[model samples]
Target chain A: MTAASDAPQVRIDGLQYCNWSREIFREMRQGGLTAVHATVGYHEGFRETVRHLVDWRTRFRDNEDLILLARDSGDIERARATNRTAIFLGLQNPMPIEDDIGLIEMLFDLGIRFMQLTYNNQSLLGCGWMEKEDSGVTRMGREAIAEMNRLGMIIDLSHAGERTALEAISLSQRPVVISHANPRWLCDSNRNVSRTVLQALRQQQGLLGLSLYPLHLPNGSDTTLRQFGEMAAEAAQIMGAEHLGIGSDLCQGQPDSVVRWMREGRWTRQAQAAASFPPQPSWFGSNLDFPKVSEGLRSAGFGEAETSFVLGAAWHRFITVSLPSAV
Target chain B: MTAASDAPQVRIDGLQYCNWSREIFREMRQGGLTAVHATVGYHEGFRETVRHLVDWRTRFRDNEDLILLARDSGDIERARATNRTAIFLGLQNPMPIEDDIGLIEMLFDLGIRFMQLTYNNQSLLGCGWMEKEDSGVTRMGREAIAEMNRLGMIIDLSHAGERTALEAISLSQRPVVISHANPRWLCDSNRNVSRTVLQALRQQQGLLGLSLYPLHLPNGSDTTLRQFGEMAAEAAQIMGAEHLGIGSDLCQGQPDSVVRWMREGRWTRQAQAAASFPPQPSWFGSNLDFPKVSEGLRSAGFGEAETSFVLGAAWHRFITVSLPSAV
Candidate 1:
């Protein structure tokens, strides 16, 4: 049960969708995680999304000693002070808002601070990475961005198409985030961020939370700590070290069916043959292994300050400036 | 085509659930209504409530010349300046939020300013007037009141039981409203506001919008404008004159099935035998007849200022203090 109590670094995983349990929460505490952006919606609409919120509400009640729902940066500080992990609710798709633009503010009021313009397919807001044709930001997408900006809700472009991502980066008055994605130059997946988007994000002073999920890594599950460090170094070179953090796309304890639903939610009649979550890199398997990332970053020639920034400080600063006091 | 152009009084109907149309819009204009708190939900859940919002959105788009959605006092002022009525969305029941306290802020963000704690039956929040055993504000209801007070959403108790209404009046940090209820002394109906509740409302500086629904009137369809004025006068005595306004409860152009749904929304196994909307009093059939009520109030010895206050100024003042600007 050794923890990262040796250092006072603030650690935040920008994205995760674990089969949440008390064990996982205890692991988070053990890893010294100050906060984590947990996905609450993928393809679910408003009503289903509400059920997820209720579930989280129950989890908060049950695990009050280990975790607290994070609505703002102050909540993160509070969680840290109380030695608990702060969970920030997010949506990987726009379905939760359905077709109503008013739901944006509604969701924000319910503590949904991050919303991806798309998941892995086309959405009402923008084109997803899997779409054959990228329509950039849709008419509703532009309005959603403006509303998100006004409400101080973070706009995540992790799963969005390049055109859509770039357009959103340009359109948002406030800086946007690609909450859980790596560089296309490395992994070359459609889900990875492009150089153009990276540059735009850098220019707009936005953030890129590098993913640890094997699919987004250069060498899948075999991705070594050295390779991860190298990727971080390259990412830092492209989009200043100040704008990078880890968004471990963790799916701990989840069955393959969850992944299937994620990829094929009522959108298609045809089922995909294989639909299991990819295994994580050995050195960074769970919340308990975050210290290994700090070591990896250090070995990759990052200064202590840069390592801390990439670990969680940047996310803290970004989220503090991003969310309003109350919806 | 002659309208209420002779007077510049701010006229607001505290509650309505009309079968909206351009003709209705024209009548609203003819009435010189500054605003109307229009019911968007009776027993509709979150998704259904959103559909109602979408419907209202379409109406707002189609009839932009006649009405605009009001979010605050400024919107009401804008509607008056533009010679259009401001429509403030509301719920006659707590079904829209389901059992989640979070949905309160969500619906408020969607421009729902007023929400009744119960309809004609027991809800999660409290007991409706139609119920035999009247439970006061439930545990969730207290949390809802705090959240509403924080968000500036108006606590409406028009259809709630006496115990529920009184408990809500005492529990709410902000002023609550009996948005559309007559004096129980006048009508002797459970749906009407009790003298005790009226006194409590006055103590809390709350507003009581007298209902004109025939069932809540002294003689149903035979009730005259003078009788209505006397009710208002007595209500003004029970509550302060500043706390009295008109919530016409005008279900204009709505079918009998609509009333049936309102009275029996999946609540019971037995079907209601009678379900038709009652006849409106002769002098107050539609929005166009608001001036007639004003004349009746004047005839009943209401001073010009008091008449205007009852017409709309009271609701205007009450609502301005009762809603937050953003989510």
Candidate 2:
């Protein structure tokens, strides 16, 4: 591996939804992560979102290595430089914004950098990827986009509808992202963004997080890290490595309840479809961890430069562009 | 006042988002409600939903006064007959369903009777009041509706989009309802179901709960039982007493955190606007206990039949049709 490929990767679990419990904090610490974009929204709502922040503050009041709040690119750099795990608050949907576009700025101020247009279904913005009609951005959705743009919030389209994601990519002046998703060419999972969606994100200088969830990959069964790397390579072929990063939708040590919460349709409190899939989801996740990516790069026989970009260099670009150059 | 009005009235807080704390249980017992449809889905996704049932079982397990797991109409009568507060398991949003339809029956088997189509924003079924576009029901949403109908779960449109709610009411075979809503004519709050939406529910033989939230009514500053009664009475005039009931949205002693969760929007754990509202939502609640509706009826000059119908009869019909005959 080139020096760049081996450059101490600042691993970011692009998408992870865990409880505000001590156990989860401990698990994140164990994941060998330098930074994690932890999701703070879902059934609990926005207040719970803030409470999560407070919880981190309480947990790491003095011991900053456990978890620290990341508000800008500088924060992420500091965490990487200091060997700390930085938690960048993110929302899967704009539901917390409710009907008020003003809230976009409010939450942006609260250190939430990555925010998708919607969760699994719909929110104040528009339909999610799962929505059948794939409703594009609405009038209010436009205003929300503008607010998010002005606030410099990374427009994450991981769980957003195709038309809406494209519309958002086109509308925003800055780079956006599919924070954690696989390619639809591989598997037609709702968690996978369509090629068209990827194209739009690419055109606008956005990013795509190659998801570790096998369900989102070409094969939901027994996928190895090599396949995960191949998928990232495929995306790199399209969006290029600069816009491709590791956004592992990782969930380690979360209770069965947490997994169940995600499978439930978007924005549902009691929304569940019954337990058909296995309780544990991280089997494929194990293959997609940061270290595993190194071995996968070998399987792909990726060029040194490309492998280097696939590692942390790609994410480094995203973080740099997302925050102000001044910082 | 008529003798019927004076007769010990059976009251229910209808819907409450409380922690089921010992104090909360005592508050319910003291509130004089024969039962309360305590929300189990919002904070408790799947396991926690069960946890609430278990918690209630333990809290009021042997008390005999607090009936745990009353999922249908029968629980109310059994609770009323047994002098216990019937605890109904309801979901504020269908998020627990996640992506599976079969889970609907599983949840039904668990005694989760009433389910809101969407939370403050969106779900698999449709867009919520906060969603920018009323894209009506998506494909999965229709399936969810059909599943709920097949399982005999009561469909709640309280937080649904105007078009979606109207469409759901039309699509539903069983009567649907806005478990908590005010006439849009009463107050212009988005929380208030529009006249057209209410009419659709009325046409479908659905019920409308008269929420005690003063902002939903025109009489916010001078709010009183009389004004509240008039709100229901007006609903009765438009949709008849059979379609009228009390949701109360009676959040008493509920901390600011809980309210923040409610208004924070459906897509997240909570909204950024959490805590932007009042701490104690006790201003509008059943102060005289559950049977306070008896006083509300008498003070409003409602006759024996009207009082009976509004106070408990409306709910009785709703439960009878939705649940088993026992309620």
Candidate 3:
């Protein structure tokens, strides 16, 4: 391992939803991760999602040496001081809240600091990226967003469609984030954000964590680390260095069946036969390989301070602003 | 409004926990209710509680003129040929399937015909009626009481105590019903079950659904119904009367606060300060007063066909043999 002084100053991955285990925790330590915004729920409803929280509590207890639950930016700082990776809970879908608006406060109390309004279809809140007609945020979505803003929870729009994403940007009183998505200018997938959204995100002082999932990469799974880093540099030129950071969207150690569940949930009766786990790019396979992207950013003509900011400090700054002061 | 000849023959009041609309489905077609089980859930888990089914997709649309989601006894012969009142869904506590159990075939497919393990305290599977030391259910109770035996899903042990109820009558190979409790002779409380549990119910294939909701009313709630019907004389007899019936744990047109939550759901942070509703014993205050309970049993005492059995037959017959042939 490199000397402690050589490590990036504040290495936080803006998002990850790995099949977490002690091995992964060790890899986060190896990767010099200060913290991770970990996805806790997608299509899971409230009670089932509480079970997930219980599972995470067990994990936190079992792995106390390597990780701690991060409730605030100060927790992240404490993790860095203790040489542990802080895991902040996030949700990729609003299904956990179900139809009840009161549950927003309940979930926030349970340590969920971030939540997306939709996943890949029409939700009670908003439309997902895959929905054909984006009606923007629904009536319930507006109430939920207002509650989230009051509680200072980050509104994520990573899986939201064009109009919904844009509307959320305009509606949210607090700055929001596209926690894991590339610019559509770089990767033409529906999962990536358009240039217009990026401009609005920058205007609103929102953060954009560039994704490294294969499908969102320009050259898919064959994309080189250097090429990926250069794309980050180009995105920084459009959205500025202060808003750019890495959110690998990593799916390390997950089986193929889990991928199907993540996509299909219980929304449909039939299995999503066509959907399967894609091959991860060789340049960045897991938390252990996070340093490769940091190194690539350096090699892509970024200065020392700018590289550190893009690597993690940008996300740290965003979180410090996003999370509630009291919570 | 109909003549006595045109009135529905069967009348059952298995249970009810409605946030009752005052309209009352035309007073259950003026009190000729063929069957009524009519209770939803208590301390239910969020997603799996089948609120969608309770929302009554079919009842709200196609079958509004006839029934209310009874999955038994041919929907009470199609609500006595469209006069309408067949509402059979029972749940006393939330501990039936727990989380690990696979939604139970009877619950998911057949719509939860009946479930009662506990209502007063901690129950991994058993122990109710406020035991000082809840030893919890025996190993068999842990195995699959939620799975429901082949005959039908009627496992009511109304406010049972620890050891007696948790033993579950030697793990119950077929089906069992305590339908309602008036058993101070067994344990001495509003929540006791008498030696009849060991006797008539086991030997004669009888059911028991006797409750007036004024806490085991021998004298409470004015006690007139007891004398008017010779309830003591009939109950002293063997359980040959097809297991007796009338679980009138009724609270109709209750205030919204009464239904704010059945138990203090996890949604609330504070304990419910005023935990009890007002007294409700003005001679069957709702569902058009259920006059059959008063008039029929009185005439039956003069050597009719045991009007208690008539009052109970539809429910007993429904539960004795089977749940719905299909959902």
Candidate 4:
């Protein structure tokens, strides 16, 4: 093995739910990605959610040379040693559990590491960011938080409402995370986090994974790396530098239907006009653009170690701390 | 209407999970049943459980002359006025909620009244009687009990483990029910309630619906009406006569596959030997056997007023007090 390949790498994309293919696996490898938390559930119930795991099993088998399914931080280290990307499964919503708290462990047993309480609508646990009246964390939500904490499964509040996120952060014994979202000050979208949330998140020592999704950018598809870096710097100022990382929120090859489903999953009958996936920022369209993010962070005044932390080191440490020791 | 028809008939079967058909609906009418708690879920998840409601909707439409779906005490009165049987949907297992405690409200909205915490093995909420070790009510179980109480959904502990049943009774604010189980003193099956559960259930002002399922009978398929009556009298001595009713778990016309599914619901692949439905006792075979139970109770030295309570009045009063007012 080459000396470069022998060195320990800690590069990780905190979150991604791309349309998987051999091509994307190749792109991940080419980008030198050490790990990626892949989304598996949005509006699915237990059985449908299990189907997603089954689908990933085939993908792992088919792309055995490129990726490994990760259960814990050790798997990420193993992926680095084997020169393959470690894939950590996550749910973008609690829909897969479908109101039963028992299914959480079943999903965890299946290798899911991260789970969001909501996905842009009212869920059983809590109101999503898009809900009109945020009811905050619900009775079920409290129970779910306790169970997730006990299991050492990370809680992601990226699409949760303000109060729900705050309540969860306060309630959780372990640090929670905003797996993929930019600051609301950077982009006025409901999907983005608020200054108050960032402060609370920082207090809990949680990580804020800055998003590269065009809609979460200030200038949308036209957002430049310099502007993105400036936003990162501001976020780092609010949430400590160590609590920042890249969660690309990349939807590399998914069609418009997937995005539409994400927005209007069985909640309404009215079809949204012109439904489609927003164009990603030019600098970060696919997995092969990790270098661009690093360059942007450095150009925005991040030190070598700080830039490295934002790129993946922070996520690696957060994940290591969040997961159960035996796992 | 004649005085007989105008009277507020409260002849309710606390539980039944028959292979529902128009013929069965006619039999229920023939039996002069005022209401029936029909089991709609056993090992189903959210969507599949909803499908049961959908099926019941169709059944209601098809048999409008015979049955009406009951949402509350008022609906039972409506069914009595219309000379039809009110069908109150219930879940034999919490599997319908799967792992999401939020689904409890969704099921309630769809007209489910009673939900047991476990079926017959280790569940997320607690242990079933079949489980080797009883872990009692789980974290999710406590949350579920609170939500159920808030929504006015009756908590049923028929098939739960001893500890789980006791924990649920202690935890629930409202009166819980053992919708279908005989006293263990009579049958000695894991499915039967213990003296401890009966005493606790009575203290909470809960009702124990004496079951007519053959397996729960002292002599199984050959159990005589006199024997059944004696068991009810013994149960009444321990539990006040007002805390008893009929929950004949009459699985009329169902194939052996249904029983197999109930016993080994994807929990084991050993494929239980000779899996089949047990034969019903000669005294109670179908919905048309309500009069036989009344006769049995009367022969067992129950006074006319107390016999009426066991026949259905107690269930009516308990259900009226259990359900949410608006519902």
Q: State TM-scores per candidate.
A: 0.73, 0.47, 0.57, 0.53
Among all windows of ten consecutive residues in candidate 3 chain B, which has the lowest summed lDDT? B101-110
RMSD of each: 6.8, 21.3, 16.3, 18.2
lDDT of 4 at A51: 61
Query: What TM-score should be assigned to candidate 1?
Result: 0.73
lDDT of 4 by residue, A1-327 (tens): 998546855788988888899999999999989999999979888767766776787789799999998988888888988899999999999988877776676577667889999988888999898878998999999999998998899999999999899999999999999999999987997789999999999999999999898888889999999999999999999986789998889988999998888877877898865479877877888889977898878878999889878988899899888887542
Write down the RMSD of candidate 4 (Cα, Å).
Answer: 18.2
**DockQ-sorted candidate list, best first:** 1, 3, 4, 2
Clashing pairs in 3: B207-B243
Docking class of 2: incorrect
Q: Which candidate should be chosen as best, given DockQ against the real structure? A: 1
For model 1, what fraction of the real interface contacts is kept? 0.28
Q: Assess each model's interface with DockQ, reporting 2 decimals per model.
A: 0.20, 0.01, 0.04, 0.02
Of 3 and 4, the candidate ranking higher by lDDT: 4
Of 2 and 3, the candidate ahead on lDDT is: 3
Fraction of the reference Cα-Cα interface contacts (below 8 Å) that each candidate reproduces: 0.28, 0.00, 0.06, 0.00
Which regions in candidate 4 have their CA more than 4 angstroms from the true location? Answer: A1-327, B1-8
User: What overall lDDT, based on C-alpha atoms, would model 4 receive against the true structure?
Assistant: 0.87
Give the total clashing residue pairs for model 1. 1
lDDT of 2 by residue, B3-85 (tens): 74564576655566654555566666666666666666653454445445445545654555455557667677667666667
Candidate 3 ranges beyond 4 A from true positions:
A1-8, A268-274, B1-126, B130-327
